[model samples]
Target: MTLLLIAATVAVCLMMLMAWLPEFRAEGALLRRWSKGGGENRCSETVQNVVDGFIGNFSAAHNLSETETARIREMKTRPGMMPVTLLLHPQLVTREKGRFGRGRNLTAVFVATGVSALIMPPLAGMTMHTMSLWLLPFLNTSVFFAGLQLLRCAYSDLGLLNMLVTGKPD
Candidate 1:
């Protein structure tokens, strides 16, 4: 049972890593550039340019209508919004008509992350007797926070899903 719990935890972590790897890489590059003395204005401009290119490519590939394109552009301007989140917004909005492919796969990944986050704490607690008292709390805490982050991503995806389905913000 303990082995199973550890395996499940590892699997969930791996799934998250695969889903977020692209965003992680982008952030890492941005961080490196900033650390190398890229001024705030320059960094912000670079981010905007990159986001614009992504939005343009995504819009073209998805054949987004003008209104959908405008919506996505507006979404990008929102404070603290991540460009990656917009990647699926158009597809999700269009999905109300029963057409979309890749977004479903991404959504599945996020849903799995959320389910794992809900299950991990109890699973970790069940295996607590096997670890050092100090180590158990540390491991549990790390897993809890990681789960929370994964849940946040899943929650955001759910909001996107809700927006398209119910025609309202979540």
Candidate 2:
């Protein structure tokens, strides 16, 4: 059972890391473009292609209108606007109202995941006094990855809130 838990935790962490690689690559490309003096076409073709693909996927997922999609595509070309465009995406995407709106749902997830990640270790330590030492390390590693995930979500949420309030991405 302990080995199974460790394997599952490692698998999940690997999957999460894989999911974030594209965003990191895009950000790196953007930074490199900016450092080169922010020309209209400073970004490499690879970066442009990646951004276009991301925009297309986002538009299709959200079922955005033709004009809205065009606006976002235009936003991609402007220097420093790509981050702002992405930060404002949750507002652009439509979803049916549930028990909570999108922002609240994100807040709830942030709070729940945070509490679980923080509380798990100590509680487990106290309850599972006989737990193997190897299992404890795996548990801690999972919590650490969960914390990283929480930070990523928090950054996105904060960026969205900043854009909504100040009309700028931080």
Candidate 3:
């Protein structure tokens, strides 16, 4: 039974990993589509430009006042720590849900991995070493997704990652 589980897990992992692998053509196509106006209806360029200007102005002030002055008193202090504090507060608990959900998607890819990991061992009918050949690929894919998820989350924190959080407005 364990061997069967191992084999299934292995195959599933490989499939998921392959699906998630980087494809230059696919990425380039997506970039071109977005540039041509795939999502321009979601937000106007004027709005984005205004937001960018506001963020730039605030960031400059934040850097000059909080970072520069605080640097003289302590080396370990960071000026941008306050944003993270808001993220931790009750008014902002959704951040954790969003983070864990992203993480869970990465981990959920393991369901296939675990199945493959379990199936490979018994299918081969080898009793001495039960480890499936698929385990490495499973782990590798999981790690890859985990890293990608983290990158997504980090971009979101920087306000550089934008997605349609809701359906289009009628």
Report the number of the highest-lDDT candidate: 1
- TM for candidate 2 is 0.48
- Per-residue CA lDDT of model 3 for 49-153, tens digit only, reads 433343344334334244433322131122122122112111211323222122333344445445544444454454335454444544544644544543443
The reply for model 3, stretches above 4 Å from the true place, is: 22-159, 162-170
Q: For model 1, give the RMSD to the true fold.
A: 6.2
Residue 55 of model 3 has an lDDT of 34
Ranking of candidates on lDDT, top first: 1, 2, 3
Question: In model 2, how large is the Cα lDDT of residue 152?
Answer: 64
lDDT at position 136, candidate 1 = 36
Could you say which candidate leads in TM-score?
Answer: 1
Q: What is the TM-score of each candidate against the true structure?
A: 0.55, 0.48, 0.26
Superposition error at 143 for model 1 (Å): 5.8
Q: Write the per-residue lDDT of candidate 2 for residues 111-164, one digit (tens) a residue.
A: 444544654465466446665544544554564565466446545544543343
Per-residue alpha-carbon lDDT of model 1 for 1-170, expressed as tens digits?
A: 66665666666666555655544666445533443342333347776666566567667866767766566556544424443443523332234352333365456565655656665666657656554433433444454465456446545654653454345664
Superior by TM-score: candidate 1 or candidate 2: 1
